[model samples]
Target: MPLLKVLRPTLPILVGASIMLTLGMGLRQSLGIFLQPLTRDIGISVSDFTLAVAVQNLAWGFLQPMAGALTVRYGFRPVMMIGSVFNVIGLALMAMAHGLTSIIIGGGILIGIALACTASAIAMSVSARAVPATVRSTVLGMVSAAGSLGSLLAAPIGQVLSEDYGWRAGLAGFVVLSILMIPAAWYAGRVDRVPLPKTSGDEIGNTSAGVAVKAAFSNASFLVMTCAYMVCGMQLVFLTTHLPSYLAICGMDPMLSAQTLGVIGGFNVLGSLFFGWAGGRWNKLMLLGMIYVSRSLILAWYFMLPPTPASTLLFGALMGFLWLGVGPLVAGAVAEMFGLRWQAMIQGLAFMSHQLGSFLGAYGGGLIYDALGSYTMAWRIGVALGLAFGIIQIAFALIRPLSPPPVLKAA
Candidate 1:
């Protein structure tokens, strides 16, 4: 099995997508490390910072479908290149911010839009288009695994720099990293040159975006998956946005948050590989349900106990193993349902649901903490919602297995 021979043609695209994904997601996820310093220095509340993050998610979600559709009209290269530039500008603004308006514009609006073009959805779509269907899921998993390394590197670098210098310096460090996205996006744009693979007559590969979106919304399984995806966003974003503050409240060292994030990134590689492989063999929606269930249980267990280095690290490892695995599963499932032509857009539609949940997780958690001065209520709600959604996802998957929606030829 000469894997290299098979992948050689598309290797550059995959590599570029992976690097873009790593830095884009990594740097964004690590922003929580700056919350304390940024808020205190700017004389803003925790809720303010979280609000910007929430807006970022909202912007990312709302613009994703548009970005994906543009990829269909234009090529991925141009859309992604523009996004890479946005990432640079956004980070630069954050690094120089003296007020909330700047943070909202840079961190919330621009970076949010940047992610629409550079993060998981776009990255996964690039990989899917670059490879054969036979190996698409595995390759998606591999790329996702590789992309997970960004947080591992970003967290420690930002945390160290911020601790020694200032929050702005940490963001400046991220700006340097984001510049690399320009070249990565250019290379990944090469996938635009690879003609879309042929699909069955029944698949909606040639449908207009309007028609395809209608068909996607009409499907029951996709709807269920999209709803469950919201819970996924809620749970994951809550952690990334608030976990450092939680640790700080617990009197843990600031460095622990970065280390924990690094651990999660390390484990993301394994989770992506495992779930990517599992998705090809098992039911993707069911796998998603199980991951959510496991995450809720872990959340319950971790937050219930006092924070220790060992326990915190363990939580990071466990949680990390479950993180980003969704990239391959969701991406693969979208491709299976809609075909590659609109996979990015359809996935973006689902991601809109996920981002709505992210808005809740990031902002809602902050609001609760501000009011109560404890995260007890927030985590409780998250766990309850996660368990309910996970069960629903698993049950719905078992009852109504996924099938592609009908596509009518353009009249």
Candidate 2:
């Protein structure tokens, strides 16, 4: 199909969304590098910095549904522009963070909200609309891979900046990068919305954005997808934030830490793309089940692996391959069952669950470490949760998608 005169080609929209996501997540992940440094600078405990990051993660989860709703209502242009502004403000405040309040509100909450707006929910929706279903997964993976690209850069760069410059200066680098997203988002909004495919599931119909969100929350399949995603967030945020520090304290080299992290990012591109393809070719619920089960195994091995470069590389590669595939898988599933007309909002609500998980991951990991004086316990908890989540997801795949809720006429 030809690009709409007013809308850009789907390719550009995907590219734009990818750029925004990469920077947003890349910069956020880099905060782990600064976790100890920033806390020490402000004379606060790790708990304080963790709390701020936790708030940010939770806020992103809570706000995603709202951002998705707005995207459905007004188009992605204005909403993405708003997200860009939030990024600049949040990064600026984070760079100047001198107290807990500054860190929590500016660094944490604002950034989370921005991520909800521009991350997978925004990017995948655009990709789903633009490409044929046959290749949509590949395109979606490509977009997500861009985020890993950012993660690849953020670590070493963040370490260098924080070590040679200061945490504030390092954060300022993200601030400058974030400012460039404004126009890119505007272009993304111009893509024409694609019609949803016909399937055995309920017939997706046109509805006001408000009605769509209301109905999505009430729908059973959407709920299952959302709930499953919540755990994904928790696992991710907790691991990313605390892993390096734990490794370092265990007598590991700093270079190994960075390399392991970078390797994860590199392998994740493969995971994201493979999962995207799997979503289209097979059942989404089953794919999720497999991913989670594999995660449980990976966590088990990761805990057993001694602190060393070889083990670190192997673990990083394994986990990275499993990361971020959830976004495309879940988002594509929602779009598949409910249709695409209200996708932005419905997908956003589901992503909120992810944000909540992220909150737990960051804050809970920090809390566990502080309380135990070791990450051994934290790693054990992760293994249990992964197994439990895998079982729950396997059960979820057995049911058929429920019908969309009865549409109400306007009063």
Top-scoring candidate (lDDT): 1
In model 1, the Cα lDDT at residue 239 comes to 98
Let me know the TM-score candidate 2 reaches against the reference structure. Answer: 0.90
Summarize candidate 1's per-residue lDDT along 361-392 as a digit string, tens digits: 99999999999999999999999999999999
- Minimum summed lDDT over a 10-residue window in model 2 is located at 402-411
TM-score of each candidate structure, all chains considered together: 0.98, 0.90
In candidate 1, the residue pairs with backbone N, CA or C atoms under 3 Å apart (3 or more residues apart, or in different chains) clash, namely none
Give me the candidate number with maximum TM-score.
1
Clashes of each: 0, 8
Model 1 TM-score relative to the real fold: 0.98
What are the per-residue Cα lDDT tens digits for candidate 2 across 143-262?
Answer: 777767777877677677776888788788778877877777776666545444543223445556666667777666667767777777777777778877877788886656667777
Candidate 1 ranges with C-alpha deviation above 4 Å: 200-202, 408-411
Computed on alpha carbons, the lDDT of every model, listed in order, comes to 0.93, 0.75
